[model samples]
Target: MSKIQPLNPERIAQMAAGEVIDSLGAALRELLENALDAQATRIQVEIWPSRWQVRVADNGQGIPASELEQVARRHTTSKLDGCSLGFRGEALHSLARLGSLTIQTRHADDAHGWLATYDRQGELAHQQPAATALGTVVTVADLFADWPLRRCSLPQTRPLLTLVQNAALAHPWVSWQVRQEGQLLLSLWPGQSLQDLLLQVLPQVDLSDLRYQRIQEGDSDWEVVLGLPDRLHRPRPDWIRVAVNGRFVQMPEWQRLIQSVFQHTLPRHRYPLVVVHLRLPPEQVDWNRHPAKSELYLQDPEIRQEQLRQHLHALLQSGSEQASRRSLHLIRASEAKSVYRVTSSPKSPDPAPSGQPSTPLPPLKALAQLYRTYILAEHPQGLWLVEQHLAHERVRYEYIQRHWQPVELQMPVMLEGLSSQAVEQLEQLGLEPEPFGPNTYLMRRLPLALWSEDPEEVQGSLRELSRCADLEAAQVAVACRGALRNGIPLTLEQMQQLLEAWQRTANPHTCPHGRPVYLALAEKDLARYFRRRWGICDRPISDPKLGSWWELEPLGDRFAAQVRRSSSASAPDPKDETRSAPL
Candidate 1:
């Protein structure tokens, strides 16, 4: 007996519908593509309160009465030219199987519109004379109701709204309106600019601070509009939009290009807002990679990515400089494809100019301490408020990473008669022990951080040493133990030394555990908190205690000079004089 069998036609249709209409977004995308292919100048979408009913209407060339019923069948499409948005006639067939689908359409010369409904078998179940304008309107209600698994697994509202937004962004020339549960979510008139669309996309940014850059290379065009370079986002920014040939797409290659461009400019914890739109010939892209068409295939994507990177890099560099037009290349008739590059004007990028005291730590003027925990200080680039303990921890961790030493155990003497394997492992880890009596081995030394560990912890760590995966695990453990603890009081002189030490570490932003060491506020930020006489900011205060805020101010350096003169007692830093920092 043969086990293989053909699936029932209705079952096949239902399964195919699941593939094409997996989510509400995918269903809307197919309808949207059809509307765009129709050259619709106006489109409207409506969703019911339960999100089970959706209607998409478009004003464009509609189906003729004779072929209206055939549109429900699979592979029945008029776009044999390969230039249209959607060609495989699976969407309507899928919709028919997924739910009850109704389409109302009429041509311009027709007397009136006709309504047709499709059954689950990809057949026209009903048809009748209807009233409507010269266009098409498709309404699909109770979507995926027959396929309960698909309905239960998929989201309706968010996907539908996101799909509509992308469609609106791609077809900026089309007037569009979207409503959910009888309330309007988005309404846009035709002829709105890309910048106008982006304003709604990134509502947090000021409109004026957004910068736009355009590049035209032969038949392809690229536009990258973004916020100011200093605008920092903590998470991967969802506002970044990418459109290729008038269709918004999510491509990893393009995403990589955008992200890599800002890698050097921004810290690891931050991202920038970039809206990129590229227009190429229709033949250069294929949108059939995924069921929803979110993935895109580009012609020579690497070349496009490199070209886009150079253009964006030049834009950022130029913004850093005044809008001087010094970096952008003007291609002449003979050299039209010359690549553009941005180079520093003085060759060596701006000199760390004099007049500012030359030091790793920018000279800072101390302000009043905040709540006896944070130290407030002013520098040229910004006003800095530093957490007292974390700042010292950052400095000490860097020092420990550079300077290693052996620790004497404070616990019981090393175990006697340990297995040779344990002894070998401990020796391999640099914790050498020697036998003083019969099978009595004593711990000579261990990593300083582990010296004070309970005997059980030491034994456990040694037992697990071979299983430790990370090479930095040992370094991090030692550094964490060696770092300064919180609640330790610091005089003004000790605080200054700690701040200077903090500035010298390679990565002063974060400690070994990746927590921030300090919070930096700009001069304008300080002004926002404290009202001051703007004109007198540069002048020395008449009160002996308050010095000029803008100038390099001192924090008890004079008092420290006096203390050094009077007594031989050194500053408060633990092991400060013993170990010099790495050069």
Candidate 2:
């Protein structure tokens, strides 16, 4: 006897059916795709978790009565043009082999509908005449019946819900409803725009913060909708959705690319909510690579990747620039409300004198320092509360990045407790450290921003930088260390200078570590809080006499001087030394 023998047709069919209809989710996907291919504008899905059954009904161009018998036969499909989502007629056949299959369909030309049933081997069992609408309805019961383990392992609700959501995202124009045991689980009506769909799906994000853009280059066109830089984000990348040729897919490389575009603006380990749709010529797309059709291969992938990167960068940069211009105007308007006299020199370069045109800064007028941590400033539209430390950090980070050359110290600073890995990373970041004593390193050169930092603090920052895996992260660590400490009081002139430096940085909205630099309370909001209409005060009050209720007392000049000296001599409170977490 021959050692090898060809498998019988029955066994071969069974294996192929197992591959196509492996789980409840896969079976539902195939049925849903078939409905879409039939040009369905409305689809309804019903699931019975207790019995492992699924039913899908659609208002589409249904199967003709003449071809109804052959619908369950393998390789028998009317869509030979390869334009439909399901071109191979194996879906119904595989479905029949896995469980009981029934299809009732009526074409537009037919006066009546026909109902057909098929057995496990896909053999036609019964046929009857039925009155029905102009569409198709398919039901599959006892899915994976023969494979007890697979049937028991299948999820009942979440998988089905996710599948429906993915389909709905790609086809917002199609009305859909998914029910479980006759209880409605999910529903989407027709006539919804793409932005509306996104907002409905992701309720956590604000609609105004979302941005939409469309780009067409060469043989491909793309539609992108995403949150503004760091405005909305999630802990993981699960919220990023991508669709190719109207089919939602799992494209890991594409998701990573999108994340990389916003890496600088978003905090570490955070991802923005984004939706991307790419439309390419059918010839350039290969959907046959996966049985589930969840992955695709595109021609000229390198060219497409490069184009996407450039366009996304431009879009985000443009949005940032517009926001900056608006902020500048608002700041100038606010500055017009008050006037101040400069008393002390600014640590950074001074802004241009009153009338000369220079780099635009949101000329906010500093009113007072609040709690020794926040700077209260006046803006035309509202009140701005700036986190003094983070504002300075943003300024220092940008400054260090722009001027990164190292300067040799007259006397080398010795750092201890640095690991070998940390020492190597420090050197790569332009801080040349040489081994001195046991577990100690001598830093001969430092970045200009860190040249004046105290030796002990520099050592601490260098130790922190040594643990960073990348040069950019190390630089951020260094910048955070050199920034002004919290709880340190600032003079009026110093606060003004700090705000100018902050507004001049490339990204003033967030610190290098991605913390917001300031919070704005618009005047209009304040009016609402007081139950007054904008630009109109509902209640009028006469000016009160202060001396009638309270008498003014002045402190002795010697006592005031002593209090100032004590404050200047005090060290930073340990409770206020909160630092930004590492990237």
Candidate 2 clash total? 2
What's the residue-level lDDT of 282 in candidate 1?
76
- Residue-level lDDT of model 2, residues 189-281, one tens digit each, is 764556667776666656556777778877788877787864667898877888887788988888889988888687566888788888898
lDDT accuracy of residue 376 in candidate 2 = 95
The lDDT leader among the candidates is 2
Candidate 2 similarity to native, TM-score: 0.57
lDDT of 1 at 8: 87
Clashing pairs in 2: 334-380, 422-466
- Model 1 bad stretches (over 4 Å): 6-8, 49-51, 153-156, 232-234, 320-583
